[model samples]
Target chain A: MPPSPVAVSAALNVVEVAAVLAFAISGLLVAADKKLDAVGVCIVAGLTAFGGGTVRDVLLDRRPFFWVERPQWLWGVLLLCVAAMLVLRARHFAVTRKAILWPDALGLGLFTANGTQAAIDLNLPAVVCVLMGVITSVFGGVLRDVVCNDVPEAFSDHRPYAICSFVGAWALIAAEAAGWSLWASLLVATALTASLRLAAVHMNISIPPWDAGGGGK
Target chain B: MPPSPVAVSAALNVVEVAAVLAFAISGLLVAADKKLDAVGVCIVAGLTAFGGGTVRDVLLDRRPFFWVERPQWLWGVLLLCVAAMLVLRARHFAVTRKAILWPDALGLGLFTANGTQAAIDLNLPAVVCVLMGVITSVFGGVLRDVVCNDVPEAFSDHRPYAICSFVGAWALIAAEAAGWSLWASLLVATALTASLRLAAVHMNISIPPWDAGGGGK
Candidate 1:
């Protein structure tokens, strides 16, 4: 049987909360690495956690941002930043490429699902919805990397990161087109994206960097 | 006597156009320096020219982004990028710190006035209006630097960049509060900001970086 609406709403909430925490942690890691002040650290963390949603809302012309709607998310990020700062040693703080990928994959899936669903609910064009999904999953990391003075790995890493979200969004669209229920579509898309990301990394799969002559990255 | 409403509107239009052109050129120059493709150059240029205004509109929950409202801007940027690519050599593409400052100061001033007026029209709180103005003036450069894999000079570089915009925005607010005409308020704010930025640059004045205990930028 299809999941009840109440169960689905609860699941969606859990997924969103988890995704925000994951993105916030990722941002704080980079900010702390930069040796920024506490205020700077929290600011960067907040940006990373909220950047995608803000962009999505902006593009859709929606009002009262997600954080504004649930102000607790702001406190949650602040608390998380403080706790992580206290607990993480330099050793624990050491973030390898692989180390960043796991949580990123999971967050990517979760965010993409949420973003695509939001656009789809508005009956937007499929392409627009997919792009929104990709933007939602990828832009936070882009903001994080950009603030840290690095080229966004989403654009530069030659990994299948955004492409995974793109495909996952398409999957959700396809599931809905095929008459699947809302929760089922979201879960399937999320699972596909996260697993696909993990598999790509495990196998060292990559995308071709933009062929910007011989000089570009 | 205060300027006629028609003249004021015309002047505001001129300022907005000039500011966008200036910023777009700034972005294209940096992207070309990196040997980005034609598409990349155009994208960067568009982001730099439009980023701040987009942020403002997003923050205010405004519909139909400026570019969307004026689709011709998309074409204008594309044409400008292509023309620039044809006319400029690698030597011309070389941008010094000083080189980026002049047009930037002008754009900062122009955008700040427009942005502040926008928020003031909506009767937002003074602080919110001022911040909106700052974001409108400063975010384009922030976006440009971020895309180029550099930390935003606004947040780093120990320069009195955003602060200048802040003061300029307040100037606009102050003028309006003093019962100045709308156009007069805008010009006063713009002139104050652009001149202040030039004066600061000429004098080698800078803001102190965040005290990251000898670690951060």
Candidate 2:
């Protein structure tokens, strides 16, 4: 027999809360690692937590943004930031937006896999699904850096940020095409993205900026 | 007599093209005024044309973002950029992000009115309506500045950009409440917001940044 609708909803709610917390912690970790001001920290935390999912929901035409539907959870995000700050400070984590490279890479992998999986579930077009995955994983950190007044590290750091997520999204598609189990596909994609990001960072991989033009304007 | 569905659709497509052109021209005006790089100019133009509506669509769960639905318009945006660039080049307008303040003010009002009207049509909550208005008017510039690697002048320029739009959104609500016609309400809101923005810019009105805290981090 199938689970009751209420039971499924309850389980989904638990998963969502856990996902939000995880995403928030990644932001908090980045904030802790960076030298962002208190306001910057809060903005990064909030954007990191909600930005990607919000974009996905909007693209999919899902109503009542998760954050909007449960505004109380926002307070939870704030408190989590406070708690993360206290703990990270106690542990003497380096704090600066630059530290974003670490946790952001992990987030890139997780969100890329999750977003791609979501679009796949919806049976969206292949290109659209891949784009959604990329948007979900990359947009949050982009917002984080934008608000913090930096060229988004995802775009400009001479790094392979979006590329890693892009590849990871494709990996999910490949995995499913190969008849992999859903859980296995998700894990493989996430791990592949995260590990690739880590490898890129550790190896100091680079991508050049675009060429300048007439009047360079 | 009621128009045929095809007739109405054709008319809407025409209106959409006109609106897109107007929005694109506003961005071109800003790019023409500012001393931005070529890439910056293109980014600004594209964002100005599509940013707000894309955001609003996402929030309202409207599907196939206008640009997405009709990818051809994207090429039009690119061509528009090219044409605007040449015309502005021969005419010799100031070129710098600073030029953003002018056309941006006009966009603020127009998008604010349009966004608010869209939300009002949906019968969303009042606060949500106001926010949608603000997002539609302000988000494009935010994206433009972010991509240009400048702190969004909308937030950091010590200006009343968002606030002006905010008030304009409310004005639309009030106009509707007072039984104004839709066109009248839209015009009133747009004119009010744009003029307010102009006033703020002309006066160099400012808002202070948040106070720094422990570690100033």
Candidate 3:
């Protein structure tokens, strides 16, 4: 039997919170690497955790942003930033390349699933729903990179980051079409996306850069 | 006598169009400088023209973006980009530093006034209204710079871009408090902002960087 609507909603909320926490950690690590001040860390962490959802809500014309409606999320992100900063200061914790990957992948999967569902709820077209999913998964990191004066990893990293999100969005859409429960679909999609991202990272997979020479690379 | 409501509305529309056009041109020039492809040019120009207003609308929960409602604006920007590209290719029309300053200043002024008015109409808080105005005037350029892999001129340049917008927003608020007409308020605010920005550019005025040392520079 399919999960009840209430159960699905609760599961999704858990996923959202987990995603927010994971993304915030990734952002805090980047800020620490950049040697930004306290304010910069807070700004980056907030943007990384909430920026994509904010963009999705704005595009969908949803009032009172997700964080705005749940002010606790904002406070939670703030507290996390403060704690992380103190922890980093107290002990010389080196943020290696490997440190951020797991959290980033988990956030990407969860956010992609949630954003796709949100757009589906709004009755947007299928393509747009998928696009929103990709945007929600990737744009926060894009904004974080941009603000930190790094080339947006989403655009230039040549990785499977956005591509994985796109595939997972389709997975959710397909599962829904097959009449699966929302929670089941979310689990499947998130697992697929997260595994694919991790696999890509492990294998050092990459897409070629867009050729400037006018021929498709 | 104060301008009629109809007249004020019409003038604001005109200002919006002019600002969009000027900002689009600035974006196109930047794309050309970076040797981005045609698609890149279109994306940059579109973002530079619409990004700020889109951000303001999203933050304020306004539905159906301005360009989404009036797609002619998007078409107009496309045409402008095409024309500009052809002209630049046909003749080496150097896009000098001076070439961008005037239109950028004008767009900054007009957008600041219109954004402030929009927030005021929504009855937002005074600080939020001022911030919306500044975001409307500057966020587009910030987005364009980010996409082009350049440091956002607004934050790092410290050349009074957002400061001019903030001052203009306050000017409009002050004019309304003094019982001035909408048209008069807009004119005063725009002139003040544009002039200040131009003056800053001309005089090479810049704010000091945040002191990394213990001492405030």
Candidate 4:
């Protein structure tokens, strides 16, 4: 028998669409923040949505990437960007813009869960699955950062639980393999990432320091 | 057998250094054109130097990248950007400055060589090696464009034989596999890429339009 699809395996096609839209918003927000031109905004938004999946496909040697296989993903990003541009020109968006960080954070959570699940479905080792989750979750942002000319926050000192996404992904996988329901595992994983990130931002919590063997701070 | 030290690959290495420096300069020039700050300049220069290689490694699953493994590469890029800034500020650079286009073309030639050689060393299939070469040559500039709010030249309608790098890399590989010496293969590939690019720039060369099956231009 063929192996199972990842969590919500039967409903994966739906999840994929949602994940794409979420990440597209992540890209769109950055483009808007930069006040990019329409073409520029669309490209960035599309890249943010599909970049991680593309990297995953290349790494896993899966051909005809997600966006390539499903051209609608690209269309969605383009349309979304165009809509965003229209909205921006029509009125100055306030703090409660439709494409806000919270929605993006939800997308990040779903992507982290789905990516981990996909890696697990590939029958890779647990550590690799977790790594895949982190890579997929933060990849869009990393591309965004690189384009914005900043060192990737995921690799830098400031962010908390950017690494925790990897940890949570592994936890989800372990639970699923131990006969937990797919929903239970995904819920746990998503909650872990969202709460950790939210707390980090709001409470200014951080991961404890490693011993650097130096006197600098 | 152990691979030859990069030093034994002296001319190729020199070309690689020149390529990296030229690429870094292009990145810095763009940043300066945008009137960005010092951190932004370093970020752009560093990305231009390392972005292609990093993308290649991630795709190939090669971890602990060259810049990460040899921190000296990062230091070199940082110093180059700093030196450029000092020199630019000390005098009006326009009279003395060679335009970025020539250096960008030169960088493209050398990076194609480096990337082709690396793929060959890895024993990837010939098509894959050629593809890797193109990735190594242009993805940095693509990333730079995306971040700087410009369309990627690679995907734009009007760019020249950026595609030629892939073609030349394959030719070099086939020649080497057919018993050509390393130097001979390198010369042929480099000359083909540079001359073609110059011709394309001067002659307004472009990809020939496919004869649409429906029979329209």
Candidate 5:
């Protein structure tokens, strides 16, 4: 039987809210690092928090995005952003440029997992689900970079394991398709991606396409 | 009866492609004015062209957005951007800042109409459609401003009639819902919006409160 409307809505709400918080924190940290004023920080936070979900919905042919449907999601993000700014202010702290990777990776992992789950719930094809997961995980960062007047960091050569999202998302999709429990798939995907990214960051691991002479047979 | 999927897709493809080119050209003009190098110009052009639709899709809860669905669209945009750069190079042309408004207004009108039509097709409420239309038309410019490291000119006092989008989109939605022909409604809306914007530019008229506040409002 089809899921009841209320159940469906509840599930969507839970996932969306969780994902929004994850992304918002990521944006907040980035804004802090950039030393943006409160309004600028809030704008970045809002964009990062909603950017991925909005992309996911538009691609899935969904309408009146979650934020628009329940505007409370936006309000929640706004409040969290304000709270974050206050906390920073109270501590008399400033975020240096060096202080922003962990939260971003964590946010990426959570968003990817949530997007994959949303796709699976919608009964999308496996490839599409994986794509959605990756898009959801990355588009917000892309938007953030553009706003910051930088090339999308994901596409830059210095980025490490940025593609981890696609790898782990595909793995999660496979696991779920193979009958793994939802939470199990989510945990595995999130852990796999985050760990890979952290390790890559620490080890200075890099992808191999730079050597022009190596490609020829 | 449901519309034939093939026909719908075909029409969507044509209109969307046209819209993308129009906006890309507008972006190219802006970048040319700034004397950005090729990479910068391409980035700006692509951002300007796809930015609005990307916003629209996300807001509407769509997934695997049009660009993602067809990676070829990215290639097309890239090629056009390259061509634009070559043309500018060959002619040693300078894009005067003053030359941008007409094409920009045209792009805004087309995008607004297309966005509203998409929302209406999705059966969204009229209010939502008007909002979507405005978002689709203005978001690219907003992103452009952000990338250029400036406040979106629209948000600043110098620009007025940006809200013409909100007004015209609503007018179009009302007309269409009242059983006006699609072409007639679209043309009327676009003409009205473009005229109002051009007049605002010529007359140096501005949005009332925003224009008068002079910042820090």
Candidate 6:
């Protein structure tokens, strides 16, 4: 039998928390690379961790925001920010270009699945659900890059970021259609998304930049 | 006696539509300045026209979005964008730096008052209501500049943008406290915001940037 709704919700919360941690770490690394102060780091980290889900909730008209409803998640992100900042400072670690990839991949996969699930629960159109999943996975990083005055990697880098989320979201939908259990669907989708992102990064794979002759300018 | 709630709401809608038009124009100018193609222009214009109110609605838990509920607003912005694009193309008009200021100021005033009134109708705390007002006024332009890969003038320029909205929001709140009619409050507040913004621009008034040693890093 499928798991109880309550069981599924609790499991989803755990996954969300992990994703938040991963996103927070990526935010901190980006802030450090930008040479931001402590407050800037905190702001970037908070925005990166909460931005995507906040946007999704707003789009779905969910009241009280996710972090507002569960203050613990906000607190968890704050705690992680402090810990990560301290560790980086103590070790005098220089942030490398690849530093954000692993955690960002984890966050991308988890958030994509969770966002898709929430839209499914709301009975939105399938296309919208998949789009929401991609938005939830990528918008935080987009916001972070924008705030830091860099071109949003999502729009400019020509990377496979949102594409990975898109495919993974469909995978989850397909799994459910194929009569897979909720847990099985979530696990498989998340794994596929993370693996795709990691592979893209490791292999330096990217979509081609829009050509000047393509009417982009 | 104060204006009837229905009368006030109708007036507010008129003001909001005007603001949306102004904001859309500014977005188009910015996108054109950046030499974005037609699709990019449409995206930026739509974002600037809708982004702030959408953010406010999300934060306030208002459903369906303002444009989503009244798709006429969406249509209106699109029409304005197309019209402006054609005019600019036919004339080969260069987008001047000064072109965005007037419409942007008008939008700041109108959106600030409308957002504040919406929060008051919800009976939120006064400070939060004022904050919602400022946010609704400024966030769209911020999003536009960021997407265009410019430093958000709201954060970096210190040219009395958000500060004007802040003061005007409080003016509306204070007028209400003193038993003014809703129309009176909105008019005075909008006038105050627009005048302040215009004066700041004409006078070249700006707050000094934070000192390099102030630790913003």
Which TM-score value belongs to model 6?
A: 0.61
Off by over 4 Å in 6: A1-4, A14-51, A54-103, A119-135, A142-152, A163-217, B1-51, B54-93, B96-99, B123-132, B143-152, B155-217
Cand. 2 Cα-lDDT: 0.71
Task: Summing lDDT over every window of 10 consecutive residues in candidate 1 chain A, give the lowest-scoring window.
Answer: A89-98
lDDT digits (tens) for residues B1-217 of candidate 3:
7566677657767888899999998998888889999999999999999999988887987778788878999999999999887767623546444588899999999999988888877666565677678889988997898788875667555577878888999999999889988888889999999999999888998754323211211
lDDT by residue (A1-217, candidate 6, tens digit) is 7678897787678777888888888888888889999889999999999898888877987678778878988888888778877666624554434566788999999999988887877776666677678778888988898889876666545567877898999999999889998888889889999999999888998754323313323
lDDT of each: 0.80, 0.71, 0.82, 0.70, 0.72, 0.82
Models ranked on TM-score: 6, 3, 1, 2, 5, 4
Candidate with best lDDT: 3
* Candidate 1: docking tier: incorrect
Cα lDDT tens digits, model 1, A1-217, are 6666577656666777788887887787677667655545665787888888778878887666666556678778978877766666565544433476777789999999988987886789999999999998899988777787877878877779999999999999999999998888999999999999999988999997556856854
Q: Which 10 residues in a row give candidate 2 chain A its minimum summed lDDT?
A: A89-98
Model 5: which docking level applies? Answer: incorrect
Q: Pull out the clashing pairs in model 6.
A: none
Stretches of candidate 4 exceeding 4 Å from the true structure = A1-51, A57-118, A121-217, B1-12, B61-65, B68-73, B89-98, B207-217
Query: Native contacts retained per candidate?
Result: 0.16, 0.14, 0.12, 0.03, 0.08, 0.13
lDDT of 3 by residue, A1-217 (tens): 7666687667767888899998998887776666555555665787899888888877787776666556678778979977765555413334334667998999999999998988887779999999999998998998899888987888877889999999999999999989988888888889899899999999999887767745745
Model 5: per-residue Cα lDDT over A63-132, one tens digit each: 6677777766666887887776655541233342234467666767777887777787888888888888
Interface RMSD, prediction 3: 7.1
Q: DockQ of every model listed?
A: 0.12, 0.11, 0.10, 0.05, 0.09, 0.11
Ten-residue stretch with the least lDDT total in model 4 chain A: A90-99
Rate residue B193 of model 5 by lDDT: 77
Query: Of models 1 and 5, which has the larger lDDT?
Result: 1
Highest TM-score scorer? 6
**What is the Å distance of residue B38 in model 6 from its true position?**
11
List, residue by residue over A133-178, the lDDT tens digit for candidate 4: 8877888778876665557666775657466677678778878878
Candidate 6 displacement at residue A212 in angstroms: 8.8
CAPRI class of candidate 6: incorrect
RMSD of 1: 7.2
